[model samples]
Target chain A: MTEPLATGSTIGILGGGQLGRMLSVAAARLGFRTHIFEPGANPPAGDVAHAVTTAPYEDEAALRAFANACDVVTFEFENVPTAALDLIEAQVAIRPGREALRISQDRLTEKKFLESLGLQVAPFADVPDMDAMTAAVEQIGAPAILKTRRFGYDGKGQARLHKAEDAQTAFADMNGAPAILEGFVDFSHEVSVIAARSPAGDVACFDPGENVHRDGILHTTTVPARLNTSQRMDAVLMAGKILNSLDYVGVLGVELFVTSEGLVVNEIAPRVHNSGHWTQNGCTVDQFEQHIRAIVGWPLGDGSRHTDVVMENLIGADMDRVPEYANDKDVALHLYGKTETKPGRKMGHINRIVR
Target chain B: MTEPLATGSTIGILGGGQLGRMLSVAAARLGFRTHIFEPGANPPAGDVAHAVTTAPYEDEAALRAFANACDVVTFEFENVPTAALDLIEAQVAIRPGREALRISQDRLTEKKFLESLGLQVAPFADVPDMDAMTAAVEQIGAPAILKTRRFGYDGKGQARLHKAEDAQTAFADMNGAPAILEGFVDFSHEVSVIAARSPAGDVACFDPGENVHRDGILHTTTVPARLNTSQRMDAVLMAGKILNSLDYVGVLGVELFVTSEGLVVNEIAPRVHNSGHWTQNGCTVDQFEQHIRAIVGWPLGDGSRHTDVVMENLIGADMDRVPEYANDKDVALHLYGKTETKPGRKMGHINRIVR
Candidate 1:
């Protein structure tokens, strides 16, 4: 096993959004400093990070300097350019490694990997061209989603089809980008398990949290997700299977569909996930800290929940309720330090503990 | 009476110690930025603060720029030079105000102010010179402590007198600095209340925590202090009384001695105190955030703790056990990111919640 990052050593983070901002704070809690690499000027993580390299992913010189300055590197988002990671990896080790990123970066690759592990996944077909799209639509049938294989998030780059006749229009929306057609599952609700793994191969998982989405954005995640003893075990066990398969290091967010037949995988995130925010109030070790620990090679923290929590996101217009929610004694608010409040933008979140 | 700080407003902090570091993190949680003004190089707070001014307090140009950049100013240390505060106050408002500083900067003044409010404090006499020392010795008697009137911390600038004959030597130790001689209070243990107040006259107080000192520095603080329901009420009432009397904005730490007869006010810190570290893990709103909320004109947060916590300071040698303590899943460690560990220096702390 490698030595954990020394106290006061710099850990370079590849993204500077809310997840990176929180990871910086958690790194500080453990006596480590974080350096952020992002293209955007005045990124939210810049406010807390020890240093920031404001250059696009194509800036090899800047990436090299940032990598050289850090003892180890980690990314808050899985979609970071592979070429940038190649440069950083040559200078410093990147936790959660290249394989995890390579698989999760594309929907087709991720689905195939999960299926290879004997895990249940939605019926999916790759669509590289119009001919492939026609074949995929025939296999997946109607009530399916056509999503860009790369860079898809927050319900973006997606087109839903009601029948085979709509496949041509949905494929046209892809703009010639590689795509994946996935059959919709008749699941009751979605729940997610936030799991962590250390380089030493220790695994820890937080309890599943039930998720609700509105306007294609996460609205709330309530703990004590409607799962029975066996389903909870199934969710955790499946998450562990994925982490172990990848030899993963750091936190992973695995969203799953709870169906009467069994649990089917929805998607996976290689870093701290929004669905895991409830851990901040419900458990001793939140997802942010757990990720930092795993990447630094520290022992995985106990993630047992001590209380029930409901995590509500304050997106754009929802920022208006900050004052009203701030008055509630049980609510713990965490804002991202974002300056603008655009519609559907995630501004902040509050974890209200159930007394 | 004044507008609350805007979401992206900058909050200037006057020190770059652990308190400032934690305060910076707290301010970010509320979508506010922080600029730390510290004279030292590579201050611990610099790692997380949005901006840093590394010039001495006497640098008028730097102080002006720092103040001009901030919406409001607050300090982590009470003994900041008066001239620096004078310059900053002209440009921006200072929370907790000058009156609190004036009283807390001098032990004699602090004691006199306590007496003025009908609060119980140890019997004390002032010593400005040899003649005054002799008079104070006669008045306060032996088995007393002689402490400098200003800038004394961590038991420095203090001398203990076993008897009246020892007063001459203790007086010599002061080097002509103004001092206060106080008879020791016969107390079983020490407890402190971490309280907060807003400009609108809103007030809130956390439960008192029992403190243990080692080598004249805080060692550990345990919640659910040995206070009966009445004593608990007295502690909260006294803390609120102090805040209301001063019209205080921001959090204050008040230490009291638990004696059989009654509770005695030991002293008060105008800023966050080391004894209140337990609040980080035990309460929804920690003291750092509460201080920010108070200074920003936001409603006072709920300071009520949800569970029992034992906060132990990680001093110089105590850091040797970081890995050991880290292995314990029950301990939530918070390090200050300090590169060096000197004897009696605070490196970090941990809050162990009782299951």
Candidate 2:
């Protein structure tokens, strides 16, 4: 048998957001070196990685160099271009490979893929134009969301259709981009299950966390999410189905809307998620490290939550209150080193472990 | 009052070891950047810092530039030169300042300082020469340790005196350096208290961890150290006293020997210590982050452990077992990413949390 990826191996990470930043920190903790590849100046991951490549995604030469430097490659965000993946995969093994990214990057494609797995997703229909948008509204009805098939995150590239006239306006604003109309489910609450699957087929998952959102951005995620045993099991089963189907390795966050009928998969982020931040303080192994171990081909760690944890996002100006939060003796303030904190920017987060 | 240190402020760190590496990671989490000043290539902290100055301590021009680039400076090891500290202090604020370093770098001075604080230390006498060594052996008897006053760690620069006749040989072997002969304390155990004190006089300490050593290198540290309530309280009090007396503003590690009578001061590490590694997985806020907050004049975080933890060091050959450890659940492995693994060198560590 081939030798397993050993200590001192370098892990290449795509994207340099806070997720990549935290992932680099976790990888370092596991005796693995991390090299970050991002197309920006002073990215958060740049501050913690062994090396960083600051060339644009189109720079095949730099991408090839980064891939050659690492034993295995993983991404922090799912929107990595297909060309970038192709360039890196030519030289280095990319975990949670192209199939996983292909399915997750598009709203319509992801929903269809989930349905193919016999998973329950919100009622969705593809809309190519204003006429189709109107037709989709008629089929999915009012209170549905029209989201671009590609490049949407934290509620961006989305528009809610409260009235029929809003559909045409939404379509025009979307620049006639391919879109999907998702029928809004009257959910009792929202929750996310973050799970990791190793190349060795070892799957470990943290407990589902209850989520609350502000302006479509996640506000707080509390563990022991108000779910019964069956609900909890359903979340885990859904996450596993997705990972197994995609032959995925590394962490995938599955957001679900808990309707009165049952749990409905809202979206699948093929990487670490904000809701999993609670694991940083509550679980024996945080989601970042779990993702690292999974991509590195190591057996997954114990994903058990050791404490009752509540994680709050310090969006934009909310980071100013870190000092006040630091005094509570109950909260762990974590600020992402982002220089400019504009409105809706995710600046940091605070994790509180309740006794 | 002056403006609080804002996000993006640079924190300069001296001595780029694992402690510095972890400290840089923590500082980045706070929206603060780190610049590491060390005299070698691939120093541990250099892997994560925003900037690194690889120059000797005597490179005053480079030192000034590093200090100018940082808002404040701190260190990860106590043995950094006094002149180095002087150069940085002349240009910027150095937390846990020069006085703390002066007392901690030299065993004789540290012992005397502890004694002056009305804290109990092992009985000791300064050894200026072979005659003084003989006199110290006569007073303290056999089974004592003859240690050089400075630049000793992991049992280096120390020799044991098993008999009265060994004093002359031991002293000569130490090259007649300024030394101290310490009577070994008949201790029941060894424990360490890791505490952080901010400039505002706020002090917070994690629960003491009982330490076990092998070959004079730390092997394991367990939290909720098998100490009674009284002893735990004593450890906390002793650590706090040291922080307050030194006007220290950073994390301080106080190693104490639990003797038949009570806890006796062993040696203090002015920065994060190996024994505190368990806090990364066990506590809401770890010693590294706490140190970052303190030195930046930010409020201190909670130093409470949420679970019982055991931290094992990955010294030299032990690093080879990292793959096996990575596959194990409940283990949080941390490697320094050092290129070389020389015999007896500290490569990394792993913390296992047992609830």
Candidate 3:
């Protein structure tokens, strides 16, 4: 934005899921308006958004109107089609910039970008076809995971190559899509840093949170993660390096594999991440607001941890425990207003202060 | 409210000011939708609410439609017309109940109700007319304040009787309105306890916050008020007594005057009060969510304080310092999204965590 978005300025959010819902609330807190653009009917974010346009990204007319209405545009979905962004970017600035999105959209490009930054990353080789898969397995060995280069989330579009003999099967699972074989790196645990950088180059990172995965989906993230002083610094420094390198101007979630060697970059999300949800209860300015502040060119709030927090995602059936959790002291619930409780769907989350 | 309002159920709010705006955001956080029934065009709450009914309370059709659309209804503005409420209450549950609203709507009734509960309120007597004013001043003595029995707030509709001779002028200031005489009490400072009660009779109270007012408007509220343990206990007990007496099923704010003799009941606000704004940063579940939980039959989230906080109201010109406050660490800004900065109008507030 040429200037910090003034109070009542509209912020256009790309997707209308939980993140957009929260970003909308945070925008209201900061005196800004939010307009959600999503092709879905009755999007969760629409409940809180000032305006919502139910039109596909391909609709240039809708994109133009949305772009014109917004002071600045940002996204919850990283895989927004390049053509849609091209249309919107022509009218309004898209925060985190196209470079961050371009690099993070494809796993292969993201790995190469992180590797080029002299960052520690999992061993990987691009597998264009079955022929390349053979070479990738020959180099990366067994127990590697074959993942599609794009549109992969929550363990989707991925297959495990448990042994050298499983390469063909894993390759077949890709369905002729461009894939990458990631070599296994044994790690004690996983952690993520949620950080924000203003357009003015000021950066702020919330304390890293230790994460646990259940069925390949994020189950819980506890703040004040068990990391030595050096490990914590390494994690934060790595986040700053990536943010600065990408000229990022919004919240970015960097997942790290805490290995014996050092912190390895597992992946990065260009928008607010579920792992940062604990900040809602643990910090004065949570990750959602921090992202709004950054994208608007306002100084980032101090997201430094105040209290230890454990954020647990309520996926599908986990939502049934809401009443039980509501009775728990020091627990703050952040549920998305979704009508259905489909399995594997993100229902909501709770941030429990670990007193 | 027969049972906990299921996710996606709409909660109708009676006002669309800053408090209603915050309440809407809180409701959305809990997976609930909000419909704001506000007469004003483009109210602040409309920015975050799922629906906005722009119709006056006198419009029975609008009230009926709004009531039919909501599962439960509550208010941010306490002075909602009783006629309008009677129409809507027939269709939906209005939380905190009509009893709380009835007593609080009038200064005389509220004070007498407190006095009947054995609460130490300021010395007062009815002054329904100029003829009655003389007897009231005589019984209550000089140096008292003449206030309208109904529709008074923020030091409005009040005149000070500094001496016995000032009674006629003070009484005349009432403009033939039903008035009450309040004998001034010796006090050091003011404080308030934000408390909540559920239909099941569960009561929870946040710590008393010492309030400082300027020009008859709340300026700041500092948590961990300098109150003795006995004083704190008395405040909480007083709140519980008031809540139970009226069958109040939502958050209530009880303002008190700390005197050498004891804590005196200054006044009570049946809805969320500005003094409780600090709870947004100091407690796990803030007053807005607590109020929502209570009205919806959901268990009240624990509101016990976790951090020391000082909430300062940004009224009128105070909004100019927003950028400064934004750069300050540990300060959480809650701007109202008001388009204009009118003198004496509350723009927003800041919760500064006093670490």
Candidate 4:
């Protein structure tokens, strides 16, 4: 049996973005120290973490020192280089395991894995070359999205096909990388479930949050999504099924599409997702604490939402509204502490308790 | 007009205990970095703060460096040496000001100030010497407590005089320091109001929390204290009166005695108090965040409690029950990350949402 990490143990975080910043704060609340590993200088997490290593993932010496310092390791982002994980895994345990990361890292692999578990997912076909792309487009039809199998996020590395004749142009947009064509689902709304599984096999799921996207970026997430009681239950059960199937530990974000037929699995994030940011104020124990608890081999915390919350993401110029929000008694502002605010960059978010 | 501190500014905190640790976390949440100045090595606050300086308060060089590094300076404890503040204040702003510190540091001065504000206080007399002690005891009568004028906390540096004849022994316990003879009030229970005053002269007070002590240390603080409507209003009004009179620009904790006559002022802490820890989970804006906002010249947050909370301190050996608390969904455990546990030492606290 794995022993729970004692208080004062250092938790090594693989990325130092806003997720790592919030995770570091949560770890400190539970009496744990956090050490952030990020290749970029002046990471947001560096401002709050106990220690920060500004070294690339390929630096074996730095990775060794960080892994040796921590009792256990976890990543804030799923795209942590596999070589770095292989090196850190030899020294300390990595939560959600390498299998969870591998399956979720690629679009083709994630869809196939979800399908293998008898879960409903969008129809998809691999596009290995120009010939394959043409054949897949003929099968999936128009208005489908063609996305690179790896490292695609937030409308990047993806293209849309309006007709069968547009296949060649969309394939060229892939930049010669492997791609997948997914059929579009005529859904009423999008929702995501933030779930966790403990090392002891205990599962806890937060209420699904209805997501709204603007320019392919998450704009806001509102709790008590437009879901019936049966749909909510089904989403949670399906999330638990995914966690148990992967033998996963720590938090995972599962995006779903709500349709007349049923809930369809969109994708999964092995680490904490932006959609779960509402838990920070709406629940007693938030997603960050639940992630820390699971990775440290502790029992999962209560993920039940006690209040309805509307979380609005502050992207780029949205930070200008901070002073106004700060004066609003109902708004709980969380800034990422990023010095530079470029357009499309997620600067912060505010979780307002509606009820 | 004093400008509000911008995001990414450093907040310098003196005394690296649990209070400083929690304050650091709050500052981080608001996009501010914290630099902890502590006399001891390996302080609990150091685990979460961006930087730490382990130097004695008398170290002028270190104090100057810390002051230079921060945009503003504040302390978690009131007993910060005057010399250290003198050096730091010249370089940066110190919230709650020197007058508040001077008044609250001594029991005699604090009581006198409260009485001057037309607030009811326990009958007291200054005992400067052995001769004065005898005279004061005769005037104050029996069943009174003789406490040191300064540096007295948690029932320390005090002695009870049952009769006038017990004066000599009680005075001896003062260790030649200045003392105060305070007449005991016939009170039903003790409650405290955690209030904040912004630089703009706005004052906000949280609901008074009923306090229960064990062996001179705070055991638990429950919100919605046992008080009638009149008593609650009187407690809050008195707390506001003190803050406005002091021209305070930070959080202040006021302990009151609920009596038939009215609420009697016991003492005031110029910094956040243990009794106010319940605000972390019970309210959207906690005492720590309120203190930060006021000190930074920002408007105060909502001090209203959304849920009832009972905060229980984990003193010394009580740390053994952390595993049990971790498993309980209702308990929000906060450990101080102190390696050693001595008898009566506060190791951590749990804010339980009772409702």
Candidate 5:
């Protein structure tokens, strides 16, 4: 096993959004410093991180300097530029490794990966051109989602086709990029399993959190998800299988569709997930700390849920309710240090412990 | 009631130690920024705070800039220079107010304040010189302790007089500083009440925590202390009385000696206390967040403990055991990010939840 990082060692994080900001705070709590490398100026993580490199990913000198300053590197988002990772990986160790990132960065690859593991996934077909898109529509059927193979998030880079007649328009919406046509699964509900894997191959998963979405954005995630004993075990076992298959180290967020037949894998996020925010209030150690521990080669913390929690995202104007939450006795508010509250932007979240 | 601080307002902290570090993290979670003004270079809080002014308190220009940048000012340590406070108070509001600081900064004033409130305190006599020391011994009797009136902590600036013959040496040990002689209170154990008071006069107190000290320094603090329901209620009521009497607007740690007659007030710290660290794991809002909420004029959070936790300090060489603790599933480790760990210096702490 790789040696654990010593106290005071710096961890290089490749994104400066809310995820990175929370990760920096957790790293600080564990006596480690975070050096954030983000192209955006005055990023939120810069407010809490020990250092920040405000240069584009293509800036080789900047990447070299950041890598040299850190003992290990980790990314807050799976879509981090490959050129940047190649430079950083050559200089320092990157936790969760490149394989996990490669598989999750593309929709077609991720779906195939799950299928290879004997995990159920939505019926999908690769559509590289108009002809392929037509064939995919015939195979995958209607009521499908046409998503760009790479760089899609928060409902962006996606088009829905209600029937075979809409396939041509949906393919045009892809803007000539490679796409994947996935048939919609008639699932009862969606749930996410936040799992962590240490360098020593120890895997631990938090209880599944039932999720609700609005306008293609996550609205709320409630713990003690409507899952029976067998379903919970199934989720945990599948998450462990994925971690071991990829030889992954760090926290991974596995989104699943709870269908009548069983659990179907939707996607995986190879970093701290928003659905896991309830762990901050419901468990002894939150997912942020678990991610840090995994990257640093420390033992994974217990992921047992001790209380029932419902985490609601405060998107944009939802921040108007801050006063009410501030007066709440059971609510734990976490606001990202964003200067602007643009429409649809995530401003913060509230984890209210009901029990 | 004073106006609550706006979401993006910056809170200025006087000392950038571990308390300030934790406070900065809490402030960030609440969507507030923190500017840390620390005389010492490379303070731990600097890593997490939005801004750090590394100038001595005597630097008028630095002090002015810091005060102008903040919406309100609060301190982690009680012994802040009065002159610095005078300047800052002129620019921004300082919570817990001057009265609380003035009373707690001096041993004699704090003891007298408690006595005036009808709270029990050890019999104490003022000792300014040789003659007064002799008279104090006669009044307070032997088997007493002589302590400097100001700037004493962790058993420093204290001398024990076991008998009348030992009084002379003990008096000479005062080093010309004004002192107070207190007859020791024979107690069962020591407990501390962490209480908070908001600007609107709302008061809340966490359950008393039993404390264990080694070398006159706090070693561990365990929640759900060994106290009957009546004793617990008595402690909370007295804490509320003190907060109301002072018209306090922040967290206060009240140390008490549980004697057979009643609970004797040992001293009061008008800021977040070390013995309250267990709240980080056991409460929805920890002492640091409670202090920030009180200072910012917001409604206080719930101080109820949901789990039993034992907070053990990792001082100096104790950090060597960090690896072991890191491997423990139930242990929540907090490291101060101190570069050097000298003897008796608090490096970090571990909050291990038993249940």
Candidate 6:
């Protein structure tokens, strides 16, 4: 077998948002260099990385240069343009390969993939056209959500059809973009399982985190999620099944709906997830470091929890409450260093570790 | 009050060693830019910093350019030439001011300063010449250690004169460099208290870590040291007295000897220290971040421990055990991206957090 990249090797990151920023920090801790390829004038990750490429993703020459400079390329977000991945994959290795991204990009395909693996997922129907939209409404009923098959996040590009009029108008508002209509599941609470798998097929999973949402965004995640041993094990099993199916080489965050019947898979994030922030304080190796290890072909760390932890997100105006947490004996405050605190923005987080 | 430096403000560091490397990573988490200024070609800190200046310490033009670019300045080592500090101090703000450095640079002055603050210190006297050395030996005894007042570290520039025949020869070997004769305290153990003080006079101290030295170099530090509550309290109080007296604005590491009678201050490091490595995995905020907060004028964080921790240094050839650690559970490994590892060099450290 080829020798694994040494600690001083460079890791190329496709995006330079907060997730990339955090991952870059993790790579540096392991004595790995990070080179950021981002289109933005200023990327948070670039502020600390060894090198940065500011050209657009369409700049194939710059993409080649970035790939040539790195040992392996990994992305922060899965919605990265397919062409961008193909360019880097041709020039260098890309972890959590393109197949995983293609499946996760489309809502219908992701749901179907879960079904194929014998996992219970929320019932979803494809809306091919206006007629399909009407048929889906009839089949799924009111109070269901219609979402675009691709490029949607943070409550964007999705509509809740609570009434008959809402269905047709909402469908037209989407301008007939290919979409999926999901029937609402009666979930008592939402939880997520963060699992990592190394190239050698070694798998490690963190304790499931019970998540609370605000305005369709995660607000807090409490570890040792209020679930029985069986339920927790079920959540982790679903994540491992997904990772193995995808041949995943990094951390995957699997969101689940805890229904009266059993656990139902909601979605899979190919990288670190907001709900897994509790791992930063509760677990031995956090999701950030685990992601680094997986991408760098290193052994996966123990993802077990030593302390019960509650992670509260500092959204927008809530950032002002950071000072109150500073003096709280159990609280660990983390500010994201964002310049503006617009409404609905993630400003920071505070994790409290309970012994 | 003046406005706190903004998130994007640049912090110029005076040394590019491992401490500066870790400090750069910490500053990046807060969205502050870091510029490492050192007189080396490829320092470890350069791997992650926004910018680096490779020029001799006496290069005034380069020093001016670096100071002009940064909003604030801090040093990773006390051995930074006073001329460099003078150049930067004239152009920008320097935290943990010059007086703190002057006191810490000399063992004699540091001991005197510690004793003046009503803190327990090992008996020490200055040996200015052969006559003074004879008198010092008569008073402090033959088993004492004679150390250069300046530029001594990792057991360098110091000699243990165990026999009367070794005293004059060891004293003459110092070449008349100012020296301090310290009466060795036959202590049960060595420990350290890492503390931070904000400009607002707020102080926060991490729990004392019991330390063990191999060949006068720190090999391991265990947190929640085997000390009573009163002993822990005394350690914190002594650190507080030193910081408040110096009006220190960053993290300081105070090494102590736990004697049968009480705690005696061994040495004071006016910067982030090796003994505080456990804080990276044990406490909510690591010592590097604590130093950044104090220097940037932010309030101190909760210094509470989350888990009992053991930090083991990977000195020189011990880095070969990295793969062993990578496969271990619950250990956070950090390796400096240094190109070479000579004997007695600090390559990195691993922190294991145990419940």
Clashes of each: 0, 2, 0, 0, 0, 0
Q: How well is candidate 6 docked (DockQ)?
A: 0.61
Pairs of residues at least 3 apart in sequence or in different chains that clash in candidate 1? none
What tens-digit string does per-residue lDDT give for candidate 6 at A42-119? 777876788889988899999999999999999888888888888889988888778888999998999999999999
What's each prediction's TM-score? Answer: 0.99, 0.97, 0.99, 0.99, 0.99, 0.96
Ordered by lDDT, highest first, the candidates read 5, 3, 4, 1, 2, 6
Q: Per-candidate TM-score, first chain only?
A: 0.98, 0.98, 0.99, 0.99, 0.99, 0.97
Candidate 1 lDDT, tens digit per residue, B159-208? 99999999999999999899999999999999999999999998899889
For B1-355, candidate 5 gives per-residue lDDT tens digits of: 2789878889999999999999999999998899999999999999999999999989999999999999999999999999999999999999879999999999999999999999999999999899999999999898999999999999999999999889889988989999999999999999999999998999999889999999989999998898888889889999999999999999999999888888889999999999999999999999999999999988999878889999999999999999999989889999999999899999999999897
Q: Is the docking of candidate 3 incorrect, acceptable, medium or high quality?
A: high
**Which scores greater on TM-score, model 3 or model 6?**
3
| Candidate 2: C-alpha lDDT | 0.88
Ranking by DockQ: 3, 1, 5, 4, 2, 6
Q: Write the per-residue lDDT of candidate 6 for residues B99-217, one digit (tens) a residue.
A: 99999998988888888888888888898898899889888887889999999999999989997567888898788899988888989999999999998989999999999999989
Cα displacement (angstroms), candidate 2, residue A123, comes to: 1.5
Per-residue lDDT tens digits of candidate 2, residues B1-355? 1245887899999878888899998998888899999998888888788899999999989999999999999988887888888888998888878899888888999998999999999999999887788789999998899999999999999999888778878888798689999998998889999999988999999999999999999999998898888988999999999999999988999999997688999989999989999998887789999998888888888777778889999998987787788767768778888889899999988898675
Q: Give the range where candidate 3 chain B is weakest over 10 consecutive residues by summed lDDT.
A: B1-10
Give the winner by lDDT: 4 or 6. 4
Top-scoring candidate (DockQ): 3
Residue A104 of model 4 has an lDDT of 95
How high is the lDDT of residue B193 in model 4?
A: 98
- In model 6, how large is the Cα lDDT of residue B139? 88
Candidate 3 vs candidate 6: which has greater DockQ? 3
Off by over 4 Å in 4: none
Q: What is the lDDT of residue B50 in candidate 3?
A: 94
* Per-residue accuracy of model 1 over A85-187 as CA lDDT, tens digit each: 9999998999889999999999999999999999899999999998988899888899899999999989999999998999899999999999999999999
